[model samples]
Target: MTNHIIVTIGRQFGSGGHEIGNKLAERLDIPLYDRNLVNMAAEQMKISPDAAEEVDETGLSRFLAYYASAPVDYSSYYMTNIEMGQPLSEQLYQVQSEIIKRLAGRSSCVIVGRCADSLLADEPNLINVFITASKEDRVKRIVEKYGLTERKAAERIKKIDRERRYYYELHTGKDWGSIESHDMLLNVSAMGIDGAVDALEALYKAKK
Candidate 1:
């Protein structure tokens, strides 16, 4: 059995997934990959970070459709043009997937979002987790974190969740947030961030 483990976390918008991931990584003494993933991919692809973020999870379908019909050699010439090649979203996914794999190979780490669960699904020591909270709790969290009103936070939550669902399903051909899609599903609202981290740590120890 492999000694290294990778923890992939998929989360609802206001579920404190980021915080949980940070704590888990800190406790485990491993790196945490989150938004920095975009920066890394941007650097690898030689594109601006802003450009990568714009298309991150929102452009997967268009990229897939374009690539499916485009010629295999299309990237050879198009890649030269910053905005003319494969969709930025697709490029970001490809670059980040490679980075995620490389990171897992080097050491155990906690990765939040960017479809890391699906990207590393085949790894023997991978633990795929989905973090969520009740709608009420999520809304309250979003309001406090983003300084948004209750109505605005609720809207933002729906929008982000929809984008995430589309991106994950598009890439993995699996239902996002479904019990079967993850090895473990956690409710941050009920478990709290520390509780969730402890639960994951226990699971990891048992797996080891």
Candidate 2:
């Protein structure tokens, strides 16, 4: 068995998806990628990691992403917002896709967020899993972890999920949270983090 499995996890905010990914990576002795993807993209583009992270999932904050990959007149360009445009977002997106593909080819790894599933769709050995939970469960988890009130937790969940959905839809042209988009759609509230990891491991082994 040549470490060929590529695990992609899309999760609800505060659902412990990253924790599960970490556990899975440790058990499999492979690398786990989440925030690190942004860092890598930043290094590749020679920009600040914070800037890369700002658009980690979203292609572009403005309409520029839609117009990217086309010729632009840089001769009269200045460092203004419109002039800078979506070049950075486009470049970061490309770097992220490349890094995910490179990691998929290199070894078995657990990738959390950034639409790794769609990015590595060409890899025949990839296993895409979506982790989600009920709104109430997610809110409670968020409140417990971040010390936010129930109302605030609910708002945070909605805001984060909205961004994730927008980013996924824009980049992949696929509906986020749809069962058709993932090989496995799991409810983290049902099994918790450790149990979910065990179940996922078993499922992957069965597939192998």
lDDT of 2 by residue, 99-199 (tens): 88887888788899887899888777788999988888888887787677899778777777888898899899998989988887888888888888998
Where does candidate 2 clash, by residue pair? none
Best-fitting candidate, scored by lDDT: 1
- What are the Cα lDDT values of the candidates? 0.81, 0.77
How does candidate 1 fare on TM-score? 0.85
Q: For candidate 1, write residues 24-101 as lDDT tens digits.
A: 999888899988887898799887665676667653233334434642222322233356566656777888889988
